[model samples]
Target: EAEVAQSPRYKITEKSQAVAFWCDPISGHATLYWYRQILGQGPELLVQFQDESVVDDSQLPKDRFSAERLKGVDSTLKIQPAELGDSAMYLCASSHRDRGPMNTEAFFGQGTRLTVV
Candidate 1:
């Protein structure tokens, strides 16, 4: 079975520092997504990418956060001047089809946990 891969399972950074996380979605999956999960809340979509182009990023904080999937296969998410509120789990997911009722399943990575101090 194929699975999404993420680097640096854990991260700790200062409030004003910058942090970045990497993810490699399953091969052949055309849709990729980045999500943020606060401790007790459900995952929130930050960005969605189809191939090398962005499909949606309405929830991503353009001022301090950015996500890119240049080659359309792997991606990176970065946060500058990290804030305590930014501490959470960053998850990457992929699906073979576009987001819709037909595409009910998505494979997700273990996620990268960020902690800001």
Candidate 2:
């Protein structure tokens, strides 16, 4: 079996700097999402893409965060001028929506942990 997602896994950067992470999702998954997990909370949806089209990003900080899944393959998430509050685990997940409820398990990445110094 192939790995569902691949990324650098860790990142540490100074405040006000820019950082980016990438995730390579499962081959046939059409719904992709980027989630941020804080210290003791469950992952929060930052952005969601349905085949290269953004479905929702209401929680994403548009001023400093951006996400894209152009071409509907791999995806990227970027943060500029990162703040201390931005330190968290960024998890990428993808699921093939065509599959029915029972089989539509979301495959997740081993997340990129970001620490803003």
Candidate 3:
């Protein structure tokens, strides 16, 4: 089976340092999403992409976070000057449709767990 790709399954950084994570969605998927999950909370939507265009990023902390899907295939999420509160699992998911719930099989990556001290 094809897989959504992610790397650096774990990271440790001092507070205020920049960090980045990468992902590659399943082939042919048109919609992609990035989520952040604190230890016990459900994943929070950080950004969504339709092809190469951004569809939503309202929950992303703009001052410290940014993401892009330049080729509409792979993507990256970056945190500049990360903070302790930024410690969490960063998951990357992809789906077939950009809207509606019909194609909600959002495959997830192992996640990049960031730890900021």
Candidate 4:
């Protein structure tokens, strides 16, 4: 079975440090998304990419966060000067929306849990 891949499942950093997370979506997926989930809140969409181009990033804080999918396959999300309030679980998901009806489901990775102190 195919699955989304994420590295460094856990991360710890002091406030004001930089941190990055990586994700590799399932092969052939055309849409990739990054989300942030606080301990008790539902996940919030941070960015969305379609074939190396950004489709939506209105919710992302551009001043401190950035994301990229260089080759339209794998992606990276980075947070500069991480803050205490930035602690959360970062999730990556992918879907082949252009495929036929049955292939509409999105697959999610295990997620990277970040702790900022």
Candidate 5:
């Protein structure tokens, strides 16, 4: 099966530095999601997009984080002024459909682990 693509499996940076991650969802997928997983906690949706349109981003920290899905396919997430608390696993997920909570598998990437010191 074709898989979602993510870059820089690991990232190490100093506080206040800038960091970015990239992801490419599976072909034909209509919905893409970015999540942040802290330690043992479940992932929290940072942003969600449906064919280049923002579906929900209430939890996204707009001050320092920004994301875009140009062309409605590949997406990128960037963080400026990184904080120590920002250290966590950044995951990218994609689904074929988002209209219903039906039984559909959400494919996740290996995730980009960011470490801020």
Candidate 6:
């Protein structure tokens, strides 16, 4: 995955606190996604948006994790009362959805590494 733009390269927080990560996708792309990857594991989809409308968020832990792509430009992922298991790389990616499902290339960002103690 080619890296896009992400903020706060790293974060360290204690359990039960809130943490947030931001991502700016490639210009003109209409599809955005958020993923979490544990150490030594591939990224797992958490949320997906197509022009600010949520298309899929089945994998998202809605109880504590929330994602949004407002205005179809940038996106944000927030975790409230983070647990120790929440520590992982939060990746942001975008693709041209018009290319058809699973047919477009997705570019990822240098994920935010969240550490919950």
What are the C-alpha RMSDs, in order, of all predicted structures?
Answer: 1.6, 1.2, 1.4, 1.2, 1.3, 2.2
Ten residues in sequence with the least summed lDDT for candidate 2: 97-106
List the candidate 1 regions with Cα displacement exceeding 4 Å: 99-104
Candidate 3 per-residue lDDT, tens place, 25-44, comes to 99999999999999989999
lDDT of 2 by residue, 1-117 (tens): 756675778999999999999999889789898999998999999999999999999999999999999899899999998999999999999988765556877788999999999
Number of clashes in every candidate structure?
Answer: 0, 0, 0, 0, 0, 0
Tens-digit lDDT track for model 6 on 11-104?
A: 9999999999999999888999899999999999999999999999999999999988879989999999899999999999998877555678
Residue 116's lDDT in candidate 5: 99
Residues 16-109 of candidate 4 have per-residue lDDT tens digits of 9999999999999999999999998998999999989999999999999999999999999999989999999999999986766575777999
Provide the TM-score for each candidate, comma-separated.
0.94, 0.94, 0.94, 0.95, 0.95, 0.93
> Would you list the C-alpha lDDT of every candidate in the order shown?
0.93, 0.91, 0.93, 0.95, 0.94, 0.92
lDDT of 5: 0.94
Q: Looking at candidate 6, what is the lDDT of residue 110? A: 88
Q: Among these predicted structures, which one has the highest lDDT?
A: 4
Ten residues in sequence with the least summed lDDT for candidate 6: 97-106
Model 5, 1-117: lDDT tens digits are 799999989999999999999999999999999999999999999999998998999999999999999899999999999999999999999988755767657899999999999
**Model 3 off-target regions past 4 Å?**
98-102
lDDT string, candidate 1, 1-117, tens digits: 788999889999999899999999999998899999999999999999999899999999999999999999999999997999999999999988655667547899999999999
lDDT of 2 at 21: 91
For this target, which candidate reaches the highest TM-score against the unseen true structure?
4
Looking at model 1, report the run of 10 residues with the lowest lDDT sum: 97-106
In model 3, the clashing pairs are none
Off by over 4 Å in 2: 98-100
